[model samples]
Target chain A: MKKKIICAVLIAAVILLSCCAILIQYFVGGKERIAYIYSDDKLVKTIDLNSVEQSYSFVITNSNGGSNTVEVRRGKIGVTQATCPDEICEKTGFIDSPLVPIVCLPNNLVIKISSSENENIIPDTVTR
Target chain B: MINKKIVSSIFGIILIIVLSSCNSQSVDNRAKESETDIFAMDTYMSLKAYGENSEKVLQKTSDKIKDLDEMLSVINEKSEIFKLNNANGEQIKISSDTALLINRSIEINKDTNGAFDITLYPITKEWGFTTGNYKVPTQARIDELLKYVGSENIILDNDNNLVSLNNHANIDLGGIAKGYAGRCAADIIKSEGITSAILNMGGNVQTIGAKPDGNNWKIGIQDPNDSSDIVGIVEVADKAVITSGGYERYFEDENGNIYRHIIDPKTGYPAETDIISVTVIGSDGMTCDALSTSLFVMGIEKSVEYIGTKHDYDVIIVSSDNKIYITSGIAEKFTVSSKFSEYTLNTI
Candidate 1:
């Protein structure tokens, strides 16, 4: 009887341990590593940080004559320069989460990140 | 007795393994999120659908929003609004979407007692808000344009899908079009079997359902003073959260006074109010969109009074005095962020 109770308790503890592991994985395992660049609200470029071997930079100019310079390094992306008055986008630095977006209101530019798992899920249109 | 205990123990072990595995596996499956970003309605629009058909649903929903953009854009020369604007007081045939938006605008105009009006295009144009010139219109110029700044002057015939202006009033649906598009996008996402989705037209957000994990979707309310800072977080499910603030679109004048894009129909100038921003949360995106603007114009005391008369919405008002007021309905779900910890939080 004592052996049976010990066995049951061991099984329960193992199950509980595995449950905690699963919870941790679900909450912290996936990180979005791809970034997208938008000019005037249009998706103009996409960068895959996981595959990036070296740092690179590019400039995007909107129809309204505003411009933003974007930089991408290993595992990170940011706006290095912009002609907008606020300079908020440049100060935002590098970001890698789908939740945080670097936006330049004067240039109508935005840089957003998405996980590789969500790369194909394109939203139809943005209304702002 | 030992045999019975062993049998039950094995059964319990099997059940534990099965149940825990199911929980983790189901969560993993539901975490599949499909998102798309497009430019429409003068802002970056993002749609995210979480479910089996997320990719296809997002594509279809994006197409729907783009179609609406093409049909409703005032600057798009071939759009219904463009044709109607250029009609010179003549009845112009419009698309069903354009007619519906006009009807909704008119309804909101009456509901807000003329606080929300789409007929302020002439005034806005003169102020260079649309042209990006950022000029202050003379008082004489504003008074002349104010004559055409009433939604009552526009007529919509739903049956024939026609629209007409009584006094050459040009309508600019910038105030409410984004919200209308968000509602339509949410509808498309739901109809496509996307049980969970978020439609963010700039800051105006509409959720189709709760997060797949059964937790409420947490939305951060942007601080009116700082673009990067969020003042609070709102937890909601299947609701629309729309924010209107003077800080969103504005220009600084020669002497350093700020002019917001939201022109007051009554004054023919940028809305002058102590309230910095107004956020409306409701099931209807369009109403929340219009109410955000209307409430911003109404200021704090009148907005609280206006909300008291309504049952379907809650509000978060941030005044220039640094006080944040949340309606009782949303007070429990709202959490003041550290950015606004210094500010007072009042429940109305």
Candidate 2:
């Protein structure tokens, strides 16, 4: 009976430790995948979510497709370039969150950035 | 032995369920769904469409339109617009949707130099364009109504959310409202993770991502001479293309003269020009829609010159002769239908 209790305690400890490891990894490692903008499986831009001053304006495109010159400044991102008649994508204005994608339908492109990351990464505090 | 096996099985089952649930949740969080569905609305008057992240939101967007109609219909005196209009030029606080439209109208009007005037409603009312019963208003009546044609006369303060008209000017936003709705609909779709969509608001279109097959959207520009005929086609992606023409809504006089709904603000009469249709492509649907009318009224020469000097705008002018002229910027994206062998591309 004592042996069974020991085994049960050990199993429970292992499970709890595993869950903790997962939670830490998710909060830490998952963040690395988020920079500023991810386009075509590459880190196109990385942003500091906390600093309200952290903003950028850049354009990206390949030879096959037309350029999608996006402007990111003051926590807002918008399309500034396209080959289409209606600059609807530029009119989409600034998208500050990852949920709201700045998309240009005619250009087949999307620009989005992680929002909460700006809040969590403080640098000084050690999270154990 | 049997009891031990049962205990182990229960644990295993619970573990699998928990693990699977977490996996699915994580996947759901990463992927977002978005969509823009285009279809006809009111038979011939306008095209109604909505974009959303989920089917429920899309339905809600449609439902919101229905609700908006109840509030915006001129016939409904109790509606928000009617109440606002009846206030003897008093400013009225409105809902978010109405506010968004009002702000866009004001912005477009400012940007277009009164050429895209929504306050032309007074003149339009005289012509009965909104009534669907078209008639030619006399020159005297047109001149009388032209007094209230200035968009600058419409006072709007965004911070205070106040709107007032200096003259007896009645604002009708129908010209750019559909395009505004297209922009809003696209916003909803991007939130939903619907990567691919095509939104056709009657003649104005907004496309996002690409077709599932990964090709651009083929938008057909109809020939004003024949509805069955397509003058040309323009390939668009992640943008909007809108057309305005004096031929869209018009009535012929006894002299066999055609007067269309697109009245020139300067003359308070239908714009006379050989170019029947003007399609403007821009990043914003509302801008394109409003500019399409303004540039059409401005005529081919001035329109071409104006857009030529400006950056980030292009136009396709379809002439009365079935010939098409695309701006130098967008000439490459337009393709002529072989059926119209006589038609050729001209970029001046």
Candidate 3:
């Protein structure tokens, strides 16, 4: 009976610690010039902006059945084109910093940037 | 017995993690479960709220903003403002929302002495700001349109929701409509008992209440010099932060002269001011929106004089010489970026 309880506690602790590890990875997990593209709250793709030796563009089909053409340059990311009605994501131009987020409402796409050791200081949104 | 205990313990930890991140503005909220983004009023708007009935509240907020866009948009031919502007100076019955905004705009104009005039639509249209085809109106054309530049020309019958132009004039609520939409969204969310929410309506921001942990929401001020970065961050709860900058909209003529979209109702030309960027923080989004533009047009000296310890709202401006002048109301709330630390920070 004692052995069974010890094994159960060990399993529970592993599960809890793994959850903590995920939460930590979320905040400061090897911060780099990374752009996380989420579609309907699901991370669709990750791009290291610093590693891109050349510029490239691709379309991502979203949960809304619409699609956005994401353009990745050497140091920035933007929605070059989108099937979304507003094209607000494209209008967001290019964002190289986490301060700005590129969003397409109709397509339900969100592009966020995170970088460097100053990860704790990134802002939620920027007002001009 | 051990299996049951393990199941309950793991489940409890999961619940704690979820609940703890519920109102957090950190890593998880960016991936927030209850959030919506909509494009309305010629700007992109994002709403994020936590707690009960968030989806329903967000949908309702979206509907309200769409309705406001239909009612307040000047460029939309079907909008009430468009109809009223084309009414040939005749009395028109408008919605109560329209009447209230018109009245409030006049009051702001009076307080700022015409710096926040809604009657600049005719002059704005002449400069092609209404449409994207930009141009510089001749001085004669500008001066002619400037005749109808007073908000006093807008007459409203409050009880009956009636409005009319006492003189030949046109009006546009672009300045305050977005901010009003933010206020409405916040109110709707708060009414639904969702106290923790943040909205980004284009560049304007509105917070409903404190963060879930009771900390103030941290908002960054976009660096006018670089849209990709921010100049400073302000921490606040239940307030609206609106900014007006020359870099928002502008056109360069063939001669390489750049003219921003913010026209001086007084001069009928792009406002030539000592400040290039002005931000207003207040509890009322509409007032913040109006003052952001009004202060920009008022220039730095007059803006400092105008805000003059009212304590109702605060202003932060970056002068042409790169000095930062902030009102005493938000002196402790705003922190300048290290890169911008080279500039002087003046508390007015």
- Chain A TM-score vs. truth, each candidate: 0.65, 0.48, 0.69
lDDT of candidate 3 over A31-94, digit per residue (tens): 5789999887688899999789999999999755799999999879988887754345775689
Q: Write down the lDDT of every candidate, Cα atoms only.
A: 0.80, 0.63, 0.84
Pick by DockQ: which candidate is best? 3
**Candidate 2 residue lDDT tens string, A4-69:** 666566557656766776677567655432225544434566655434466565677744466777
Which digits, one per residue and each the tens of the lDDT, describe model 1 over residues B1-348?
766766677677767766866763465545578988777776667788888789988898889888888888888998888888899889999887788888988998998888899898999888877656678888998988898888878988888987899887999888888888888888888887778888788778998888887777778787665543467778888899999987756778889987888877899989888888899999989889999999998889889999998889999999999999999999999878776899999899
True contacts kept of 1: 0.08
Per-residue lDDT tens digits for candidate 2, residues B1-348, read 645754675577557646854773555433334333322222111222223335665565555545656665555676666666667788877777667777777776666566678778778777766665567888898888898778667677767766776777777767776666667666766666666666655456766665544666666676565442455677776777888876445666789986677877888887777678888877787678778888877777777777886668788887777777788778888777666658766795
Rank by TM-score (best first): 3, 1, 2
Question: Positional deviation of A101 in candidate 2, in angstroms?
Answer: 33
Q: In candidate 1, which residue ranges exceed 4 Å CA deviation?
A: A1-58, A62-66, A69-100, A103-108, A113-128, B1-27
lDDT for position B57 in model 3: 86
lDDT for position B194 in model 3? 87
Worst 10 residues of 1 chain A by lDDT: A119-128
DockQ of each: 0.18, 0.01, 0.30
Residue by residue across B166-256, what tens digits does model 3's lDDT show? Answer: 6788999999989988988888988888888889998899988887767888899988766687888888899999999887567778999
Q: After superposition, how far is residue A44 of candidate 3 from its true place, in Å?
A: 10
